[model samples]
Target: MGKKKASSHKFLALAAAAAIAVPAVSPAAVSAKEHSFKDVPARYTEAVAYLTNNGITKGLSPSQFGTNVSISRVDAAIQLAAALGIDPQGTYKNAGFKDVPKRGQWAVNALAEKGIISGKAAGLFGAYDAITRNETARLISLAYKLTIDETVKKTPFTDVNAQWAKYVDALVKSGVTEGKTSSRFGADDHLQRGEWALFLYRLAHPAAKELDLTIMHTNDTHAHIENAARKVTAIKEVRKAKPNNVLLDAGDVFSGTLYFNEYLGQADLNFMNLVGYDAMTFGNHEFDLGTKPLANFIAKAKFPFVSANVNFTSDENIKGLVTGGIAAAPKDGSVYDAIIKEVDGEKVGIFGLTTAETVDISSPGAGVMFEDYLEKSKKTVASLEKQGVNKIIALTHIGFKDGGGDNDVTLAKEVEGIDIIVGGHSHDLLKEPVLDTTGKEPTVIVQANEYNKYLGTLDVKFDKNGKVIGHAGKLIEIDAKGEDGTYILEDDPEAAEILATEYKPAIDAKKKTVVGKTAVALNGERADVRTKETNLGNLITDGMLEKAKTINKEAVIAVQNGGGIRASINEGDITLDEVLTVMPFGNALAIMNLTGAEIRAALENSVKEVPGQFGGFLQVSGLKFTYDSSKPVGERVKTVEVKKENGYVPLVDTESYVVATNTFTAKGGDGYSTFGKAYEEGRVSEPGFVDWEMFRDYIQANPNAAPELENRITDINQP
Candidate 1:
């Protein structure tokens, strides 16, 4: 900001050109002593009217407002100095330059003292030198106190990078100036009086400039497009009322219900495009369909996608999207690290971070690697800072779990300068925002649970320094009334059309088919199923155990992968589509013969990523186990017992046991390689029943079946 140059002649030419092209409506061009002025019919009538009506500028004489003449440098300075209420009646000893006319010496010295302009050369004030566009930008920017660091790789102009980039970038960022052409600044151009008046008028009224950012966010939507219409309506309404409103999704808008099974992620993306999402990050399930499908989805996105980590080099499908560059040197048009968004005169930088666990529980396919979330996050923030962006946001799928590592909480604490985090993956229900002040400033984190039941609304207020000093966040229920008991969400007519014609047809036919009835609300939610025993988990595993018993009566225990259970079912007549939605993978039931020791090892593997939830966690039936997550991997399973004829019995290492699980896990999905080895040894048998079929059978046989935790699984280490 204090940069000094030995010569100002070249810059003066550029500044003069700018001043002439970018006109302001004022009579300053006709000389204060001249009388009649011409009424130029241009777009600046309102500004010129304001100047005349407010006495801010009187015509060069009585009638002429000098509407169409070249404005002199001294006239522009005098107008700006007067608007700022600076008393320029006193004489200055240096007079800013030797050439400053006696009548203008006070205004020139006053403006120079405020750093708005400088002499063209030693002792040469150049007060009469025509002001250029670049000069007008510099002076007005300084008047508004617009600060600039750097956010350009190359100047917008082919000829401007070396000398005029800083001034041009500042003026654009300030909302007071733009290049003569999209790719050229027209630096060596002079200012007409009209152009200079407009600049002066804007500088005079700095209060009109401001930014109010309203963010509508969702996370882990998981193909819950049924309620999407209402959410779309809500977003459109907010946008109608605000200027800088942005719509964002934290991730997992892919799998869960029959919607995803029948149409994959198409339904969600289509709806997202309809709602105009500004950006999105990758959720673990994004890789469940392999990198090719994920790339296809990304290609269809209308907006940019960001993720600081996750190497796309290993997969040919997504390699083209990875515009290779280091994290600190953000590449133009690349969404890998961070993106600078201009929102109503303010620059908001957004970056993304994915969960590292995608490697363990998700089938991202070969050639994909995840980088350290925290490390990449820090680098991205630093890069954004280098780009002159102070308001930074992290769009992450890394969740927020209490007492857990690598979650959003850790991110807020580790990465400084991040203003907010819109997150998902753990499917957390944050009715309000959680503010963490562990860093140099407060970091607000918000996640709107899972599904499309609600839209998260966050309003943040920043001081002039771009520091967030006030914020408010809330969940706006899509179909429910507001706290004041009035419905705030309306159904979008356009969204309804899309849902009926484009997105809902594939699953509509099966969505109504009944499977079985549930007495209690089955809980297969990602956050609960991965960390504890959910009734939905119990119900699914019960079906697997029943089927295994038919195969061998000796099959005493059953276990289902938590990842296989995708959604919860309300207490009612569950439909076949609902069953498929809860268990969408179409995994076949596979029975495995394992010794007690192998079973114990598999159970240990289940809880390996505990406390911080993992999809590999097992939901069991006909068996109960207690574990301490604080213990080492092999030692976490402190005790295990199998249900016997008389009662529960402690596992015997040499005892042969029959267990049931999905084919994917039996083939080592979710790090269950123990079962994989058993399958490879030909000790695993296919039960010939689809997983969802069992879910249907279990609910039919035990109508209104409400399975309880029953102390089947315990975390002894938990406080």
Candidate 2:
């Protein structure tokens, strides 16, 4: 058993190191012993050899390699700039730091010009201080444009506080470090010799593409790594089966869970680094921890972050991080505007679009504002087309439909020239790619299911002129069947030994702690909710009305946005996990008073069902209404009745009633403009009851309750 354990430890460490997608070094070119000079420590022999062979770092003396000596800030800058192939002689006037000396200052100036470093103070370069492991990790990450993958398992860590959180985020996403064990990363602790060596190896030899690429991406993970293990295994299987694929995620990866609240984002980052990602975009959530931490994460990522929309004007810290190269705008009248890639000997153009809504929802401290996606997309795509690139792909965070009763299908549809759209936001799990046939050429649009539950696989065959020859794709679900159940999770052998010592106790501690049970499986499938009202919707609406009346007896009508219902409750025992899944977003209950006439108008407005439209109608409880598709828009809703304590009563035009609904609807979501005019007269007694909690209580109180489609509200004369 000890031998097997030792073997497992060795295998895990080696696999973790090997999994790093750094640039490869030729084995036959040079060996470690040859690069070790007289004064160099034995441990740095490999690093020195690799660095020297690649012309990244030169030895201090013919017979001496300064391995143990600390790297000064100035020298560190020079060495890193050299490694990135920045010219030593260049204009240094605009580099920003005040104290950099005229002589031997080119490296610092070049790096600063490229936005890779900042001074200890305004003009002072603290050149003499020995660089820490964290600092080193950050600088190397920036030079190489490394982004962390979104797959690895999350573990808790101590010492990496809020200030250094983003660095931890990038490191994990880049596959740079896992925690010390399953529960701790010890981020502030000095990195070991073996760890540094592996870091350097990854820096030098990034991952290679074995086949065509299918990138599954997510942004704003917010510490929800519940499906991370499954996501990782699915990505690997996809990669193995179709060697030319990549997995990508945009930013906002930290802050939103008990885990993030516990360790900030350090543990989350560590796990992401272990999984490996190809690229990412910067979302505002990355700034939740602040600028320094954001910079640190930027430095530790193993993949490049693309942000053409955000401008980091005068801030020295942000400027230093963003100076690598500005991504070009997409060509005119084309989808991707300015994407760059080599696909089958053809140049494929790709640009990215973030939501305009991010300005309102993102934390204000992010210090950034989104540009208009439609305008940017339009201008960029036209430019890319003028540059002679035809195949375009837009990596967008803008939602599918503008939920405002607006038919705008994002910038992808508004603009005429995009070839493909890879989308995020609205978390819509597009089961198949939708092709827009309105244009002269078809535009293929696709999105994967959110929370990393599934990866979107898109296969597009393009001709010489960048025209699509064929396209096919699907959302591949990541389930138990795709997982191998083998994971490394730790680096310390002694800790592993101790964990082995108490393995049984730990296993027993983790034996499924039941939080709650469901009598039936709640269905929250997007299709079922957006297209038709389900049993789950009825149950949830009932909960809203019931909760509202507890505070005010007059609360009669309950309304909910279809989007708020996230999952379906299947018949059987439901776990707490299932409950959380059903109500992922923590929304609050709101009650309002409306006259019977106003209620009828709001009901009529919400029932206009249009084909191919999502999030239009309001699901209700305690009220029944019907509409006729054959009737005109204004005359759709015909009859309405409310369930009184005694029995059913025809809704009186003059009677005032209390109504219950979510805050989303209260603010007029899904184009229910009539709701915007409805006045909120009085505050209800209670306000903080969670919608799902109410649903659970309702289920417990009445076990035999099931949804009945009674035509309480309906369409006019046509029916």
Candidate 3:
């Protein structure tokens, strides 16, 4: 704080504006003597000098500033009035208070007349009582006319009452104080003389500059750690340009490549640690290996996990690691609903929301359950706001504009206070930030595409009130090789070393170790597999059936969701890496006893949205069905037949059949409610044979592993 002029030019101007007439040389000038206080702490030395240099306060004995002594209500009022350029001895209309004494009567009356001070009771001012932090807040706020952030529902302090929160909010927003601690405001505690000096000094020279925050985020990285070195280079470039930046992942750090298959998220976590990720949420695939592996992943995280919608309370492995609600000082290697992060001297609230579909699509097991995304999101935002945090970011794993389930666009439109959404799941490559102006404040939504293709960066400028005033975003390609096949970005040496020394050797060997040979190239393209059944999908289901028959001879029909088939086997030696790449989720085989009618229902669900690329499209073995695109969804299946020794026979709706499929589809993933019903009814049993292993075994046993589609699924309406 700068020393105030001895002439009191600004104070006199404020007095003139308030229409308070006082002697030219004010009471502040009467005791304008600066003395070195031996008792003043080092921290408050400048504030003490500022107060005494401007004659705002005189030492008790001209040497001791009495910094720790509590200032009484009347004494506080006199100082506040003088600081605002009002003379304590000036004539002013009396505020009716029976207990008012003559000593500082005019100062209290002048402040009361101007609505800056108030009486404790109807007819009495607590003149001799020590002023509290709340009272100090109100006094400073009114004296300086600090803008009260009405948006804040709570202050950082737990001790602050509802009535006093607004005033404290004003003080905090104006950069006057950050409470007694990050979690305690000490609202009822007596205001010390040194604290008052600091408050007054800050009020006189307020620093309410706009804060510019940069967010470097990734999503659906899916263990594509081949580009870890490139991503590190991109992240470092942004951090160098914008020192105030946070690196975040929107989830799906697990599943996709052999890295995750072999190391179970450890390789990716190592890269994340190198990149210094600020926080992450869980994606459906994070639970694909069930709770134990996920718990292990959580245990190794160097950064906290924010999972507002995921309930791990019943999971013994994860329950102890979770810290519920908003955490002011979030610890690493833990989980919380939300957290307060201070950046550039401003509090930014960040939380996580995973899709509730995880239970249906992945293997979260019975203990870990997901809550409704919207409800949990609203509560998390409210809790963060209650802790006086206004700048909120929803680091989400929900898809962007996904029509089938919860997504980011709907989140921005429905949630009131969310300022930014860094998203994943649908793997949308948002080249530019999507601005949603539908809410009370503009919310910016951004997503980087899947498999570590790009690193997304968002820069937002927040005004003094914590409202986003401006924003810009872009996707930076984390490409190691350019169009000409030359390395454009140098690899970060440390990250390259980790990959070369720790992971590359095993991954290279796995890629070269051939599992089997494919006579014809299998098609698992998104447009083909998710629409019409592909040979690759058929082969996957056929392998599942071959393995299921060993455990249960009754297993005849095999069905697999097209979504579970990730890649195609080339028309050559199929290596372990290629097999893993195709079935990277590590879905175990499951056999279900379902009535023929339930089978037909599942078939209907599989083809309902087709010709439109539904992920649940069934690639089957031992069954064939005809469906007309023109028919209604529920009635699309025209005919169903079972494969018997004598060839095709009409299906009996009442007869029970043993069906084999991946655990994901059997558990009702991809909107198979019929399968979900069976699983819930205890009619499904998991044989624990992993899908890739089964596929590998099938391919190895039959060297000529050339599986072809034999009209297993026919769209009758089409050619």
lDDT of each: 0.72, 0.56, 0.79
RMSD each, Å: 18.8, 19.8, 17.4
**Per-residue CA lDDT of candidate 2, range 1-719, in tens?**
00000110111111111111112122232333455477546555555765565454555555555555555666566556555545555466566666655443777776666666767777776665555655665666566555633342332555455555555567665665665675566654544433444466455433322224455555446555555555556666666776545465645565544455444555455556656665555544555455556666656765455555555554445656563222332221111113355433234556665555444334424455556666666666655554344566776655444331111254544676677777654445578787876655667877764444566788776544455667788776654342466433212343234334433243333323333344555566777666455677777888788877775677898987777777776676554456667777745455666778878788666656633336656678888776665677677666778888897788898988888886556645677555555522212211324466577667767665555545443334332
Q: Model 1, 483-554: lDDT tens per residue? A: 998756767888888888876776778678876787788898999899888888887888899977875678
Better of 1 and 3 by TM-score: 3
Error of 1 at 85 (Å): 39
Over the full model, what C-alpha lDDT does candidate 1 score relative to the true structure?
0.72
Ranking by lDDT: 3, 1, 2
By TM-score rank, best first, the candidates go 3, 1, 2
- Considering every candidate listed, which one attains the maximal TM-score? 3
Give the Å shift of residue 41 in candidate 3: 28
Candidate 3's C-alpha runs over 4 A off are 1-208, 512-537, 540-574, 578-709, 712-719
lDDT of 2: 0.56
Residue 519 of model 2, lDDT score: 52
Candidate with maximal lDDT: 3
Model 3: per-residue lDDT, tens digit, 263-371? Answer: 9999999989878889999887788888788888888889999999999989888999997676655778899887767677566788999887676557888989888
Off by over 4 Å in 1: 1-211, 324-334, 402-405, 481-488, 511-539, 542-575, 578-719
Candidate 2 local Cα displacement, residue 452, angstroms: 1.3
